[model samples]
Target: MSGVAPGASAKGTAARTANESAPVDDAEVVRDSRPARRGPGGPMGGMGMPTEKPLDMRGTLRRLLGDMREHRLELAVSVLLGVASVVLAVVGPKILGNATNIVFAAVISREIPAGITQEQAIEGLRAQGQDRLADMLTQVTFTPGEGLDTHALAVTLGWALLVYLGAWLFGWLQARLTAIVVQHTMFRMRARVEDKLTRVPLSYVDRQSRGDVLSRVTNDVDNLSMTLNQTLSQLVTSVLTVVGVLVMMFWISPLLAVIALVTVPLTVGVTSMIAKRSQPQFIRQWRTTGELNGHIEEIYTGHALVKVFGQTDTAQRVFDERNDELYNSSFRAQFISGTIQPAMAFIANLNYVVVAVVGGLRVASGQMSLGDVQAFIQYSRQFTQPITQIASMMNMLQSGAASAERVYGLLDAEEQEPDPEPAVRLDEVAGRVEFADVDFSYDPRNPLIEGLSLVAEPGQTVAIVGPTGAGKTTLVNLIMRFYEVQAGAITLDGVDTRAMTRADLRGSVGMVLQDAWLFEGTIEQNIVYPIATSPGAPVTPEQRERMLRAAQATHVDSFVRSLPEGYETVITGEGGSLSTGERQLVTIARAFVADPPILILDEATSSVDTRTEVLVQKAMNALRVGRTSFVIAHRLSTITGADVIVVMEHGSIVEQGSHEELLAAGGAYARLYASQFAAAAIED
Candidate 1:
């Protein structure tokens, strides 16, 4: 039987012949090697801020607040609970102070002795003796003052209990809210990153290391999650503590409060300056860590290659360089962040001394009472605690911000827009494909295939032969719509391929490529991939019988039957257990099981030996009986009987005819055939 079935082409074979017989220009022969463009990623803050520019703390906080507002109800509740807890806790110190003041005032107003002068009253206590007497008086004085009554004590105890309850409640709520937010946010961020990855062009993934992408998704998000869970809530509590304590300080003694403000700003400014410097270091640390991960992943994947090439020393040196840099960055970040707490502590101690000295003089001069000075001292310590805490939390916030920015950068990437227009759905297809004046390039500036056109009729076998980089694989990529055409139309059975949904288009078309990737699964599972898409599509005994027949046709049935589990034999990842030829046969069987109307074979039998090639070619003949097949082959002998031959050079088809016609024409194909099969010709 003739290979091609009789079918009318909208444009006859003469038009196809004219399309295939075009000449190539020398300018189009030299191809550009640069990969395609993909959208970039970074923080929402634009990328150009100089490294010298100080960190924008306000901007960082704004971003954090914006994220929190995503779950405003929970944040509001947490904040309210946090403020209430701080208020009750601050009241503890205030009540304690009032009790001391009551006792000290009684002593002051008691007319201690008729002979005791102002100097004698001052000399009545040692420098440190005042602190000791203050402690003693606080325990003694609660008997009579209205503020220290049973009602107040009961209320203070009740407030203390409420403070404990509020801390626990806020703690629980913060944990719950953090769990909900981080899980949801991480899920959303991962989804966004995945969406961007799918649409941002395939070339980007090829150029960027998989390890770097993995680090962004895994390590960076993990760091952000940890920070959000702990540092964020601590930050809120610290701010509330500082605000509440400051208020109490002003109430007890405005003089002490003003002196406290002097150190507060200084500590904050110094910490802010240090944190700003360390932010870049943290960013650098993560970047270096990412690079290290990439290297480790590469070494793991290509261990055999490295060993065989004796490059272990070189690899180790490279790894050590990145590792050492990461260590240095981490050390600098930790060391700088660590200094803030001690520096703030030193300042806090200095302020404590100043408050004690100034408040002591005021008390001695009778401008302030002794109890008021004690209360002021208590307020001073309370104020400093929060300041110290804020400084420490601020360091964490900087680190978290750096990590969050990296994560958010990935989430914010713009993916390639899907076709807005709805697509046509095809239930079944008559396999006829046409390419009209197609122009394509991975890089738009340089065209790979320019003004080329061709057609394959129903049940016809069309062989496309070309040199490397002659747009052979590019042609198949376009057919599969891995890329969109720059200026051209591809049609299937007179319908523009662009009008069909990619899912539907791919569903009806099957491909077996040079690399036959067999995922980790059973043999039966691999064969059933296409049909398995619809959960409702049930496979019956008859289908299994047909599948077995298909496997037999590809000569894989023998090998499979030999396996311990037969059809249930599991293939490891990438089919590592199988040889190249065996894997190819399994792939061919997969295509057979799908039984699509159209098949594209890109040198599918090249890995097999000649004897095995013939067996595979026989199976391909059976598979192609009622389908249109486009075959790309380097072994020209196998495709001698194809219905049409389209020979391409440097993205353009220079000459095309049947195998016999091309041999007779003595063009590029004739030369290739002569060079490849000359010795075989003598054997023939």
Candidate 2:
């Protein structure tokens, strides 16, 4: 069990412990190991963060937009609303300028004295070739010392206020619609990524840290979603605002418009340069964050082992190194991206100054009115405002793109090859398993098993005994189809295993590995998981009875009944609450309840104490009565009663017979058996 427990090494166990403990929200651990945040250019570190490679920005953006195609209608509507909103906003200053012009014109008009007749004032206006003004004044009642047309001014101001109010209302609507669209898009993206994870091969999972994978699913997706929601709407609005303002500025005064437009290229150039430089830093920052997360996950999981091995100091040092790297990368990325806003602001301010000065000159020269000059300055500000917004949004977009690239990379990873079509399914398997002329290797360059062949007749106990790394578990892995044979076929009841779907193949066999895996659920739920979740007909009362009997057979019922909740006890943290031996018993019971025609027990009792092993062996013997069983054991005593004992050495069978026959032959099995007893004697 020491050798076979997944990642059972001192360091590996420690890491697994930390990882398992992570979901529990251990505040003390988090606070102590919390990543240092040194502002913009430091590590944006968190648990389960992922490191990513440099991405092709164009490709990522194209793919991200392609993903948004399903929501194109919503996106289009949002953009249209944003455009309308910005256009309305752009038209506001001009309307207000008209109101100002009205007031200015009214103030300059001559005052009508108390004695002056309305017809006389109208005749005076007509004498100055102001026929339109004279006609408009004919309806007005002249009052003493009334210098301005107050009613006309009030009406113009009211119209300007209504236009501004309309712009605000449209802008608000645009924001609400954009939120809905972005949220829906994010939902689809998250769902797709999650579905992708289910299809990805275990090989890929084996190569990645659980934390890193989780980071991609949670943190990366969140980053993409948040940035999309914030930046996408702003992106649309900013662009339309810039364009609309530019058009209005040109209409007002093309000379001033051209001057304002000059600052745009400079702003863009500065932004592009900073973005390009910051991009690599952002990439590195995210990567380091992942590394840091991976480290933290490992350290926290293995904290128990760290204490056992007195490695706390060593672990801390490793963490600090990763944290510092994350900090440096984060600092650089943030500092560079941060410069975009200020740099853009400076250029925008400079443009505003130039427009204000130039418009003042134009107004003085009689080339433009005071109202037109004021409106032009406002348009210039509006135009530069969008450019600055776009620059700021670009920074967020770049970060989002980096995150999207990582997520897409995960989505694009190779999936498990599709199951063969028209695959065979067995309703009832006789369990006569055979491995014929199998050749395999974890790495092609270094072969682990070559030309391996084995057979187990129905209801027979076939015991496989070998020293460590003699391809014991590897053989079972092949039978289970966790890996496919490289050169030959593994068959069940004379039919090729590959001819059947993996689900069908695995469903016919029950496996109890060295390390017991229990999820966060009740003991009863874990025990009956297989039957409950099976795609076949729902579990019957008979099956429930069988489950209870199996638990009793495995002695799991003994300790379970002692607990206050009995089988109803909720197991958490991968069954950390249970003792190692107790967990093993539960797994055995689970396998017994599964009750497949075939059974493969790989070091099932290797980790338990002597007393627990005795109970487990007894349970296994009872369970094996009518099933073809493959027992991979290191302890010679466990396999002594088997009908056939196969001794393997260096991936090949060296001896095969019953225990008595093998002992009489004095072969590899005899030597292995003798050595075990010798070690036992020495320990005693």
How badly does each model clash, as a count of residue pairs? 0, 16
Q: What are the clashing pairs of model 1?
A: none
Q: On a 0 to 100 scale, what is the lDDT of residue 454 in model 1?
A: 94
lDDT for every model? 0.69, 0.75
lDDT of 2: 0.75
Q: Model 1 — which ten-residue stretch has the worst lDDT? A: 1-10
Error of 2 at 177 (Å): 4.0
Model 2, residue 275: what's the lDDT?
Answer: 90
Give the C-alpha lDDT of model 1.
Answer: 0.69
TM-score top scorer: 2
Best by lDDT: 2
- TM-score per candidate: 0.79, 0.84
State how far residue 506 of model 1 sits from its true place (Å): 2.5
Tens-place lDDT digits, model 2, residues 586-683: 87887888778888887889889999999999889877889999998889899899989998776788889999999999989889888977745545
Q: For residues 274-323, could you state the per-residue lDDT of candidate 1 as single tens digits?
A: 88778878777666666677778778767889999999999888888878
